[model samples]
Target chain A: MVKKYTKFIFFLFLIILISSVSYAKPHKQLSDYNFFKDIKNQIPRDETVPYKIANPLFSDYSYKFRFVHMPLNTAAEYSYNNVFNFPIGTTIIKTFAYPIDERDLDKGFQLLETRLLIKNKNGWEPLSYIWNNEQTNAFLKYTGHTFNVSWISNNGQEKYVRYRAPNVNQCKTCHEINNKIQPIGPKGRNMNINFVYPSGEANQIDFWHDRKLLNNIPTPLKRNPAIWDDAKYGINERARSYLDANCAHCHQKGASASNSGFYLNIDENNSSILGIYKTPVAAGRGSGGLKYIIDPGNPADSILLYRMLSTDPGVMMPELSRNLQHEEAIPLIREWISQLK
Target chain B: MKINKKIIYFMVIIFISNFSYGKIIIEPGPNAYDRIQEALILAEPYENIHLSSGYYEIEDGLSLDIDNVTLSGDGLDKTILSFKNQKSGAEGLLVTSNGVTLSDFAVEDTIGDAIVVKKANGIRFLRVRVEWTDGPKSSNGAYGLYPVESKDVLIDSCIAIGASDAGIYVGQSERIKVINSEAKFNVAGIEIENSYFAEVTNNIAHHNTGGILIFDLPNLPQQGGHDILVKNNKVLNNDTPNFAPEGNIVGKTPNGTGIMVMANEKVILEENYISGNATAGILVVSYLDEYEDDNYNPLPNKIFIRNNQLNNNGFEVDKVRAEPIALLTKNKAPEIIWDGVTSFPEWIGLSKQQRLILGPNKTKDRKTDMINLNLMTYALLPWFHKTKEDYDDYIGEGISLTEVNFKTKW
Candidate 1:
């Protein structure tokens, strides 16, 4: 009888094991990928590499952590202007966290969500994970979620934000090119700047080249997009970089908002295509009673500035991932438009 | 303890069974938004998502990217998707997949466009109603059934109201058919912009800024919109003051205008019952703004307006845009008015194929009259201009446009 009982317990254990393993779909749980050595602190595993870009998309003042993990014997193909073609089995991971206090990073942060773009044979598949309330681990959430977060601004003012985590299709809204899902960040021009690695400060391109994560790096990188808030860069370059990061993902040729006829890529130098004296095509109520998209020497009359100042869903530019206006970006864009003539 | 174990086992079995059946029916409750969205995300091709009849309070925008899926609800009034508290995303529901049909539901008070189908072919909207509940306001969403950069679209038995822009807007699309629809109390009841091969038939448009507009703007991804037929539509009483927010091209549409065609090609306005409009029944004009696109043609070409029943129109012209044309016609707007701006020089009026032809218009009380303002002469030299009241020279049997047929069955 004892032997029979032992066999029955073994069978139940086997069934449970199989059931649990089958239920844990690949990327269903954050712990399944083994991307981080420490979840709370966001310490990357040995195979993962951290990277940064020159101009980051504004995400309601959330501090972002970016990392990439490639399989063995595979590397990303470098492109001159666009995002690199990542090989299959490559995973790009981004974590969003709001620092408790903007003045100091030492004061703990509230981790919100982590998004993964996994490169497969079919194409890139996006999966979002919402962090638990106890900040232990994240779980797969196909339908999006919203979180109420509060933080202290740099000026010692308290602010609250209803941070939204986008669903899977919403990920494709900005990360789309030529009717296919693509990575918006990580272009050559946006990643050629110096990054402070754990070892030391080194040019990111050279660092990736040394690590063999990126292939075919041309000597002396030709261009680099400027950081939007950096005062040392030219005003034109800064303004163009801001637009390229924020709007060009959908506004350029063959993208979502291409029907609008306004292209804001960093390389688009044509004044007409850049919306100088250009009339709105389908702006609708987003026009804010303005005429030209960019009126020369008149920032107040420019629709671009007006849209940036709005929080209404119909009127706001970059219609996702941001609810509050980026206060720091307004003055710089205003000055650039004021001196355009 | 034994009963607890048995209950856990039962629940697991139920979960497994549910997954195997592949059936999803969503009802209203807390987290209904996520449940509905999850169903859409996880639905396979050719799956039908049945929404139970209930009022669903949606918080954010919903989207579907799965092809060949049908999202159906109980009925238009039975299943209400209200987005009055939408906080993020520009539109209420966005469909980016091909061969998708959305029917038997209503979306109300969205922050932006109500339903936007983009980059999708073989899309149909049937028995769907999109509206702002409080009535016409400039702060309402721009488009009701908005489809752009798409092809093979059919919108039938739909109703749109209180939109700030066109109630039913199809832009940069091809092969569209909008029939048996009603649009009221919106700016530009139905607008076909930068599109081709559209048939707007058997629709009722009233109490809007302008009834129907076919326009081709410059610098868009698609230009030179052509080969559209606006027939058998009831375009009447569009006398609501233009509540469109400023700086939109539609805001320039004169209030109480029946049909306006601008800078398109081969458009036919035929058999439409147009009456009770305060402006001209049919107004055809060239693009008035300076454009930078070299490939764009700013002149309306080959516009044929015939067999349309026009009555009680142009009694009170829109003071903003159409009053000046009325002043040119003895302070009275006619049944049809053409701006008479051509790409050719004034001496060489127009080739036979590139003319605005109108004739045989059925009138109720007054005589059928039309005029060409010859506004280009006034634009070039204000001192030299003459209005031509005779349109017999521009009358003929115009070329026929092919009817639009869709490949997908809805």
Candidate 2:
């Protein structure tokens, strides 16, 4: 019996080691899959499953479910419900799946995809899904909060409403505020609380696993890898990259407001040290009328937001190379502003 | 024969008396270059080339060589001098020859220097705005209102913003005055380099990387600048970050000073309210590399540093290697007494530190009045005494410690 137990334990240990090594490996090109051609051929022919919804007998409770067939070889469905009793707005339920082969359940190419069941007044609803061969741009645009789509019920009733992505901008902007731009997505905005997806699990992989969505999870990538990996960059790498591309290119000493002693160097520790966001009550021509310009949490009241939103060539941000409006980034910024606490 | 000749001369004189005076008005349409050029050459002096306040693309530089000629515009904001297609080797406006005034107009998006005036006297730039369309980091264009080697220039009430170099530069020229004008959002605002007899006053110098630098660099033959006074100006908050990669000399020194006096003589920095800078409030230094011999000389000689209130500020006056040593040494010693004489405790000799601690000794005498004196007998007391006894014994009696009774000739 002892020998048998030792062999069993050793076998389990070996399996765990092999699985960890495979998970550690970066994602490979999709062409490596022998099933790629079949999936590509099948994607165009698969009919777009119309969106569906179900309303139970609960009073004043409504739920929405949606599915989109994309040009790329991918499919997604999301569901959400308005719960009047809960003050936190809608509860979102989202799930994603891709075709796997049918064999021994553990060994099969077919896998039970990660599913997100966000609690609502009536029941659970899915919000978002991921597929194996998705077009990155189309996925970002369609899943973006700016789009309005139609959802049909099983009884043939259609409802149109706007759908939004999770507030990723809020997570990206603050970590990008200083020189080090670490997007603390899983970590809360305050860098204190870990973001556990509705499930009580603290670890992102564990949380996804508990939801019965993902069997193998990929490691998360940092928001800005190129600049953060460079050895010469110091301190707030992400914030520095954003500022250098945005504000500092025009707002530095000698370049523009040289007389005001307002050096916006990202490496500098104190924001007020260089008079960047300090109130310029009588700063002559360089002063932009608003008082206490960088008021931390208030982007609308802050002069920095006012300048970013301006279209005038003299007052607009970057002062060059921007041809299109960044409509999606606005809400993310608003969310970032709300999360300053 | 005489009558026939007279009749022919009378007919010839009568036919020669017919003429007409006409005026030509040239209006340049949008994107008109060839028509504007032809009109400029053909139109006589005092004739107007009325532009309709649209973007005018020109290749060659605009030169106003005629005297009393006016290049009027609809307004400064409406009319634009855009050089999008022009090559990089051209200036926006080249004004030479006297009596040229450009007013109420803007010259922007130029590839080269914005405005260059060479050897032009009596040049007036009133309410003239000059800028380039390149983002603030671009260095393709330099100088907003540039007057190089020109004399009797006046740049009044004009705004020069976002230039690669100084906003209003008066280089190698004399008798220039910049008043009631603003040059912010540029490399340097109103740089008076290698120029004499200029006044920079009552202007707000803020939000720049460097605040109000009067630099005298090495290797320029035109080195001497004197009689320049920087007074009554609010020079603050010049600690902004630098965007461009182009090297700046002022960055080598402290971040911002109200006035930086370097290698120039007879500069008066008085009564200016300067504060809130990352570095010193005022920096005065001589060029160390350029004039090696003069490095040891006392600068700001005949300078009056009196009655100026400096609050929350750092002040640095850099005297070269040789001059400030004696002044620094004399400041260390507290008290000096010559010709030792002692008798009383009140008349006791005191060391410099003792005198500093207790302050000056005093006494009172009663005779229906008060008389104060330090007698030689008081020297015996240890509390009030600071002098060595050997020096006291050497001098012996009847000599007052308070009085210097002898002198030494060196």
Q: Pick the candidate with the highest DockQ.
A: 1
Q: CA RMSD for every model?
A: 6.2, 28.6
Candidate 2 stretches greater than 4 Å from native: A1-341, B1-28, B31-52, B58-60, B133-135, B138-140, B243-254, B290-410
DockQ-derived CAPRI band for the predicted complex in model 1: acceptable
In terms of TM-score, how similar is model 1 to the real structure?
0.93
- Residue pairs clashing in model 1 are none
Where does the lowest 10-residue lDDT sum fall in candidate 2 chain A? A53-62
lDDT of 1 by residue, A263-322 (tens): 999889888899999988788889999999999899999999999999888899989998
lDDT against the true structure, each candidate: 0.88, 0.41
Chain B vs. true chain B: TM-score per candidate? 0.92, 0.61
Recovery fraction of native interface contacts for candidate 2: 0.00
Native-vs-model 2 lDDT? 0.41
Q: Taking the tens digit of each residue's C-alpha lDDT, what string does model 2 give over B210-329?
A: 456665543232446655666566666655443322322432334333455655555555556665544445545544332222223222221222222333332221222212212222
